[model samples]
Target: MMKKAPTPRTALAPGIAKVLKQLHCPLDVMLMCVRWYVAYGLSLRNLAEMMAEPWIEVHHSTVYRWDMKLLPVLEKAFRLRKRPAGKSWRMDEMHIRVNGEWRYLYRAVDKNGNTVDFLRRAHRDKVAARRYFEKAIEAIDADRETPIKIRRCKYLNNLVEQNFRVIKRRTRPMPGFRNFRCARILLAGIELMPMIAKGQMQCAHGTHPSADDQFYDLVT
Candidate 1:
């Protein structure tokens, strides 16, 4: 009998491959960067070092670029928009270091521990609060299916507070981020994993055919 020919790797979707290749990185590297950034709360430099390998070179600048470019896009793509409004919303703040100084992260979540919005501000004063609420409320207005009356519910807020711990563990190895934009992207990627793990997003496991293959299969 003749030996079987080797099967070729399927081509991925243009959009998916474009983004992945634009950063001069692999999907696993991109995913790992996000994971370490969010799960450990590590700075870009730390993550770069941790991800560095004998074959591939990992640098702090590369981490910075990945965060600034892809993190927000990932967040917007994966973020949940419409949900039944909870009776109340909870807001809180955490401090992280940027450029060797402390900065605050203001976050809001619904009654169900789902993220509403987040803001990074210089201080936690009334102005900062106003800014955070403005963006959060705007997001709620745009995404909500029904009108939700606001109430003060600390318990709901506590649920949202739980996110910090998970990211903190990941950050411990690196300590803090040097670039704020990169830091934001890292957070978005990190936050997205839970949603994916919970079966909310369709992940591209290597075993499956590429998006292009699916399209081609459909078209053909």
Candidate 2:
């Protein structure tokens, strides 16, 4: 029997390491704190208190600043590092309330649970759905990758709906977002968590020297 060839890993972007150097906290600690808030949808105040259990003292406002600073770094790093998703796109839309009125959240993922993309729209109509469909197609099309078909019906489109279900569950802790821009950013974070859980995103691991180096060098 022949051993399978190893898959090449994506290198961390140089900009990430450069920016992280000027920060005051440890890389692992900062990553852990921001991940908890993003993964669990904790309020900044709640996150600050939670960190206190481990003797890490930081204010809620500080946590807010950390998220603002760190999320874009992690988000871009993960996007560049993750593998291209499948071509069969499963897509859906659901209404979420922001500032007292409803809005449409368009979400789609490939078969392997890799999120294609998400968009928050002010209306839900043919034009909106079509726009989302085009975006989903664009997202899934990578080098040598073309989305073969779109699956919007419930039968084969459970992935996006399930993602929405998780989003709905996780978001219940926070009553509402202040505005659509903030709401979209939070939803994007929520969507990214699943990819990380699936082992499909940029991860820092001790056993992997390259990624471990990137993470340490950045966070230090």
Candidate 3:
């Protein structure tokens, strides 16, 4: 008897598997690693061990490097995704530590609850705020008659604040990221969790995603 071919869910997401396979790991193993970090909010070291089956042997650093290499590819693909059009938006900041120095995260959410933009900066002053606003406003489709107009955006800020609560909770479970790259990559994985949990995205795994709202602990 012939073996049944794997379906789409069991298969890799197009280029992802091929790229990972070329880098020395099997596609299935790579996908498991990716899914673990995206679905569980775990660190690279933790994910490496979690990814290992009882019959297989793997190193934690392997997972770390895999995450680092996979991040840029994920970002590129995510940027190409279509977003719903809108006029009203929100912008806000949340504090994080980069290289042990305080930094700020700037984010924008549209009226439709879609996350519009996410940026990291060293400070959260008016200049940074205005620059973030200008950057987001430019994405609007403006015309000669219907010029883009952004008066004041204070309410939209709440969405980002709410997002920060989720991020902060996850941060508390695993603290001291040791570097910005890890923090940023792990955060990217965490960002995907909300979409799935909030019903905005279909769960990649068979299990349903869960959403939470609470304050957590410090990174340091």
Candidate 4:
């Protein structure tokens, strides 16, 4: 017997719809355009230029507005997906300087280099640790299919530290955020790109296409 060929994936077929509805552009087109802007550090104008494949012309401001509008929706959808978490868990805390005032940023990453979750808190004491642990555990419990082992070695926690740098590097170029509310929203989108790159988040997984494949598939 002959095997059936796979169906062609298209923007209108099915995608991140909570965020992609009623838009003038196709689903994948808007997603990939935003993805490239984050993944390549491309300016909005640069991304707009690239969007002109044949006749469609997009402006940078349009892309900017799309990001501000869709990023939170994307983040919300991302959190609801079922993803695998490593059995070995590593946790860490770092000092975040916002407006010269210190804040505690707690993070946990699984052995597979997937970020479990992150939070910004005001303290690093036992109470803080306990609260942070509870929060991270909630996310881990939601995703992991098996039992998890907490690795006590500080060095092992380096995995989460690396994840921290992923966001830090992206935010470094900006001058500073006016407030935590603004900062949090911006970081939601920035951190999302790496998550996208890791194949940890998507609208559908039956085909299990990588994030890049979906985004590029939309553009072309």
Predicted structure with the largest TM-score when compared to the true one: 2
Candidate 2 residue 30 Cα shift, in angstroms, is 2.3
The pairs that clash in candidate 1 are 39-170, 40-169, 40-170, 40-171, 41-170, 41-171, 42-171
Model 1, range 77-149, lDDT digits (tens) per residue?
Answer: 4543223334466778777776677877777666566555567776657576756586666776787688656
Q: What TM-score goes with each of the models?
A: 0.62, 0.73, 0.71, 0.64
lDDT for model 3 = 0.58
Top-down lDDT ranking = 2, 4, 3, 1
RMSD of candidates 1 onward, in order: 7.6, 7.4, 7.8, 6.6
Worst 10 residues of 3 by lDDT: 211-220
Ranking by TM-score: 2, 3, 4, 1
Per-residue lDDT of candidate 3, residues 138-201 (tens digit): 6554443566666665665666677678767766566556677766776676665554354443
Better of 2 and 3 by TM-score: 2
TM-score, cand. 2: 0.73
Worst 10 residues of 4 by lDDT: 1-10
Residues 89-200 of candidate 2 have per-residue lDDT tens digits of 7778888878878888887777776776677887887577767677656654654454455434767777777767778877778767677876777776676676666656
Candidate 2 residue 182 Cα shift, in angstroms, is: 1.5
Q: What is the Å distance of residue 109 in model 4 from its true position?
A: 0.5
Measured by lDDT, the strongest candidate is 2
